[model samples]
Target: MPTYPAFRIHQDAQGHHAGIEQLPRPTPAAGEVLIRVGWSGVNYKDALAGTGRGKILRTFPLVGGADAAGVVEQSAHPCYQNGEAVVVTGWGLTHDHDGGFAGYLCCPAEWLVPIPDGLDPRRAGIFGTAGLTAALAVHRMLVNGQEPGLGPILVTGASGGVGAMAVAILARLGFSVSAVSGKPELTDWLRHLGAAEVLPREALAGATRPLEKARWGGAVDNVGGELLAQITRTIAPGGNIAAIGLVGGHELHTTVMPFILRGASLLGCNSVDIPYPLRRTLWNHLASDWQPPDLEALVSETVALEGLPPVFEDMLAGRTHGRVLVAL
Candidate 1:
């Protein structure tokens, strides 16, 4: 059997361990596609699972990756054929099933989306789950009545991958974006990416009470602890808050005063397992109207399969920013 490189994670009496190893290439079963994965992206969830810092995987001894962009090498489904470019994110990758950290990804054909006309596999990998989640957040907010005229949009944790993507996408859509990031070193970079202003981590600290002066039109919250609670109080009346990510904390403790008195809406964005139709629509937008002016600007670093371990450590330690691409 031909073998290929994979980032395999294992847990036993020795605890969590992950590194590159070789695995046999698999043939596609019914309704499945085998992809020659060209590129993949690292995410916070990937870091958590790789490092055993969070409960992300249902089982161990599995390949670990959340996003992949590649070309089909074999297909057992009618929708895909050999040499077709595709992307897959969020679904079962790195959760229960073996993921895209290998030289090949054998997944259900339904999990694959044809790469849009404007994007190649590398560019698609840059978007990955981060861009998808950001797109979903914007979609939910727009459907709930978010607009440039409402107020400035606030993007919490703006230096991270999803936050940066949200800032660029929101700016491209003509909304004045106020990015909240603790990394002051990237303030100019954030401004270049279309943030009208960059605020420090302490900016929202004043919103400690049940309610504060409503300053934001809406918010894309990537940090889901007290910051989410604070956003509930500060969002404008009739505004929508797209809640995504739980890096800060998962538990939510907030009164219903904002919803009852201000008509504020908190929309949950689950990028994982989104319906296929909406997934196609979001990718189309990312390729065109909602596409960022500089997709290349979001790339923080690029590494091969052997280089993923240190990247995961940096990501979990809050030292990494923007998108990290893994070239297979």
Candidate 2:
């Protein structure tokens, strides 16, 4: 019904760029609803998409956030009502569709999950996709029979959004968490997130053997490549490794020794294309028991819609930590 500010990312004849611009209000389609976005969370992928780093955008001139929380502005769907709070993540919001880096977002009702009673919009935005992936990793680990009694659980990239949340959730669920980070300065920060110990990047990178001594019961690895390959080798018998991100590198140089001898399982986590029902369940857990105790501390910054460029640079350069929220 009205025009609003939106941050659109695009690649043109000039080059790739993104900026805040005025956009017409979106109209809800059949089985869809429109949300007046209150808060949107920034992820590494979002940063990449915003800055046109990895061709993250399937189509250009799109809003540049994947996760958002807000109140329903209008609805033609049975599952949602006007003025109701909702959270949206995954379902290809930022890549193929208009995303939350706007004052409003219109999407299928199926993509919207009612913001749980206990959580506020800011809290939901803080957790966002990062918390969802953490929950997925934990859920997969549990389904694979990961147990605290087995040994310590390892979380790689433990100062990042998903890794930090994973450490907190796993530690809360009675597992002893050993977190690894390249930034030795974040050791205390990781400890505050419930890590029993913080290991330097060197500790996780020195495994020359195809199969090293078993140390962790399981691992939630957000950095792929060498770190994931190393985790695959050192996991205890029957341990599962949830390999999530490919920030370090995408290639894995490892033999099948860990899988055959140790029976370690390598599970790939896809937060973007998960089924809607399961995604809703993860959101519920994020609002309940899996919610991070120090969520506020994990939020490194909150920027306005117009202040996204420098944020993107910081993330791509690996200078950012924790979650960054965008107030819409």
Candidate 3:
């Protein structure tokens, strides 16, 4: 039997552990495809799961990556054929299912999206989960009436992967983006990614009133604790908040005044398990008009499977920013 290397994670009696291991290569079953994965990327969720710091995987001993783009090596599904390029993110990846941290991935065809025109495997991997989530947030906000004229779009946790992507995409769509990040040294980099202003985390200070002065027209919030609460209190009337992460804290303590009174909408961006139709739409937009001006600038690191542990450690420690591409 042929074998391939994979970054597999486990939580047996010995305790949580993960590392690359040789595993028997799988053949595609009916309604499935075997992809020769060319690229994958690390997200905050990957760091959490790899470090065992968060309860991300319900079942253990699975390959550990959330995003992948590659060419189909074999197909038992009608929608795809051998040599067709494909991309996969979210849908059962890195949870119960083995994910993209391997040389090959055999999965149900439904989970794969044909790599839209204008993007090859490497470029799609750069977008990965972070870019998709950012697109989804923007999509929801737009459907709910978000517009550049509303006010500046405040992207909290602006140095992180999703926040950085949101900043670039929003700027491309002509929104004045204000980025809030704890890393001062990355201020210039964030501005280059198209933020009109790079504010420190404390810039949102004193927004504790039941309703403070409305500043942001809308927001893409990655830090979900007090910062998100602060955004809720200050977003303009009818602004939408796309809540994406909880690295700061999961619990949201705020009043309904932001919703009922101001008509503020808190949109939850669950990149994982997003419906297939919407997923395809978002990918098309990402490849086309909504494409960022500089995808290379959003990437801070690129590493192979062997380098993932250190990258995960640095990412969890807040030593890195933007996207981390995993070249297979």
Candidate 4:
């Protein structure tokens, strides 16, 4: 069997370690397709899995890319054909199964989303899981009665991949976007990405009131803990908040006053395990009107497989911004 370079995570008596290694190339099994990966992206979960900071991987000795875009090299599944363009997000790519931090990937065909017209593999990978989650969050907010005319939408963690994409998408959809970020230097960048206003992280810091001044008409919250609690309390009546990440903390301390008195809704957004139909719909939207303008601006850096170690370190340390595309 031929061999290929792959980034794998392993554990032993010493400690958990992840690095690039030569591994046998994978072949398509029943209901599977072999993909020649062109691009992948570094997400927060990928950082956790690669660095062994969080128990993100269900198994060891696994590749650690949660998002991949490429061309199909072979297919044992009836739906996929050779040379087809496709992208995969979530679906346990870096958890229980071999992932796309490699030259090739063999995954279930049903997990693949065909790259829609006007979107290439590289751009799709740039969007990747983070972009998908952002789009999903916005979608859920809209479904829950959010609209451009409602009021300004707030996006927390605005400098991160998901938050940045959320801001751009919401702005493109004609919503006034208010972004919150800890990095003061990124204020201009956030506004350039379509944020009507940029607020410091302290805006949501500290203890949150059960209910406060009605501010945001809707919000896409990537930071949990006290930040989420504050957002929930401040949302306008009947507004929705899509809670997407727990980077701050997981424990949500708040009362039901926002829900009972103000009729606020907290919508949990999960990109992982989203059904194929909805995934396709979201991807299609991304490839269409929801696509951010000047996506190249969102890419903070592009690195090769061998460079993933430092990238993961930067992500975990909060030293990186926007999306980091990995060219395989």
Candidate 5:
């Protein structure tokens, strides 16, 4: 049997654990394609799955990566051919099925999106799930009528993967961005990603008001709970707020005054279940105009399969910086 290296997660008497191992080659079922993965990325959910905090693994002994870019080694479908470049992300990856951390990947042809022209596999993996989610959030906000002339846009958790991408993309689209983060050390980095201003995390912390001073024209919020409530309250009249993550907390405490009085909108973003065609369209944009000028600056580092465990720990502790790409 053909052999390849993979990072596999296993449960034991001590608890869950993960590491690199040599595995038998994967076979693609009909309608599926087999890819020789060139690069993958570490995500927040992947960190959770690697540990046991988020219950992200529906099956144990699973490969753990949500994003991958590579070349198709074999295909059983008409839409794709051998030696084509492709990307795979979302839709039960690293959860219900084996995922991208392995050297080889097998998934349905429909799950694969062609690596757009001018985009290489490594850069595609750099963007990975984080960039895709950021693009989707921005698209939804614009569709909901967020315009460049609306006023300053706010991005919470602005040092993170999603936050960094959101800031860069929003700035590229011509909106001024006010980035909110607790990490004072990331100020320079946030500005490099195109944030117009940086706000201290305390700015959104422990607020009791149902409504605060209306500040942002619109906002991309990656922190839930009080922060989300703050965004809803502080957003300008007729503005949009894209709600994405729950890193701060899950429980949100606030009145409906902002939504009812200002006509503000709270848009929930779930990138995982997005339709395939829409995801592909986003990839096209990422490779073209929507691609950030400083996309490479967002990557903290690229690690090998064995380095994932420590990286996962740092991510869970909120101690890591931007994206972490895994070199297969």
Candidate 6:
């Protein structure tokens, strides 16, 4: 058996720890495929899993990466074959199963999506889970009747991975975007990403009202808690809010006014465990018209497997922006 490098997370009497180790390369099982991982991406959930902050892991002593793009090296599944490029995100990766932080990964074939034409492994890693979630959120909003002329779309946590991607995609789709971020330094960057207006994080702060002046046609909120509550109350009639993350907090204090009076809807965006068919549809769209215009600008840094620990720390501290691609 060939020994390959992997980054593993372990929990012991002392506490949780993550580091690189040499392990035997894995082989595909009956319905799985083995891939030589070329690139992986860092996500907030991956940071939580690696740092033992959130209970994101169903099991310890496992490889820790939530998004991977690579080439298939072996396969026992009919849908995939050797030399084919594929990408994997969510589907309990870095949670219940070993994930992409290894030189090689063996995962169920159903979890794999072929890398779209014109997208390389490195570019796929830039999109990873964040881009996928953004695409799904936008898709749901459109299905619920959101359109470019409806009104401006508000994206909370605008400098974060999902928020940044949402801003870019919505702008590309011809919708005006209002981005909210605490970092004033990101104003120019957010604008460059196509945000027509950049608002301070405090713009969503303060007391909550049963209803506020209608502001947005739709919203993509990555921050929960009070911010989400504020967004819900401020949506225009018949608009939708795609709730994606809970980085701010989870408790939602609001009334039925938005739903009953304004006819607003809160669509929970869960990228994990999406039906394979929908996954394919979304990936195809992302590779085409919905793709970010400047992917390299969204990537703040790229690190190797051994450098992931510090990157996770920076992410948890809110010191990092955009995506962090991991080169295996």
Estimate, for each residue in 1-328, the C-alpha lDDT of model 6 and write its tens digit.
7989999999988799888899998778899999999999999988999989989888878899998899999999999989999999999799999889989999999999999886888888899999999999999999999987768999999999999999999999999999999999999999999999999988766647899888899999999988899999899999999999898799999999999998999999999988999999999988898987887889988999978989999999999998899998
Worst 10 residues of 5 by lDDT: 203-212
lDDT of 3 by residue, 192-255 (tens): 9999999988889888888999999999999999889999999999999999988889998899
What C-alpha lDDT do the candidate models reach, one value each?
0.94, 0.90, 0.94, 0.91, 0.89, 0.92
Task: Show the lowest summed lDDT stretch of 10 residues, model 3.
Answer: 201-210
Worst 10 residues of 6 by lDDT: 200-209
- Compute each candidate's TM-score over C-alphas: 0.98, 0.98, 0.98, 0.98, 0.97, 0.98
- How does model 4 score by TM-score? 0.98
lDDT of 2 by residue, 128-225 (tens): 98988899999998988999988999999898899999999998899999999989888888899899999988887678798899999999999898
RMSD of 3: 0.8
**Two-way lDDT contest, 1 vs 4, winner:** 1
Residue 75, candidate 4: alpha-carbon lDDT:
97
Alpha-carbon RMSD of each model: 0.9, 1.0, 0.8, 1.1, 1.3, 1.0
| Poorest stretch of ten by lDDT in candidate 1 | 203-212
Off by over 4 Å in 2: none
Compared with the true structure, what per-residue lDDT tens digits does model 4 show for residues 78-138?
8888999999999879889988899999999989999999799999998999999999998
Candidate 3 — which residues are off by over 4 angstroms? Answer: none
| Backbone clash total, candidate 6 | 0
Model 1: how far residue 213 lies from native, Å: 0.9
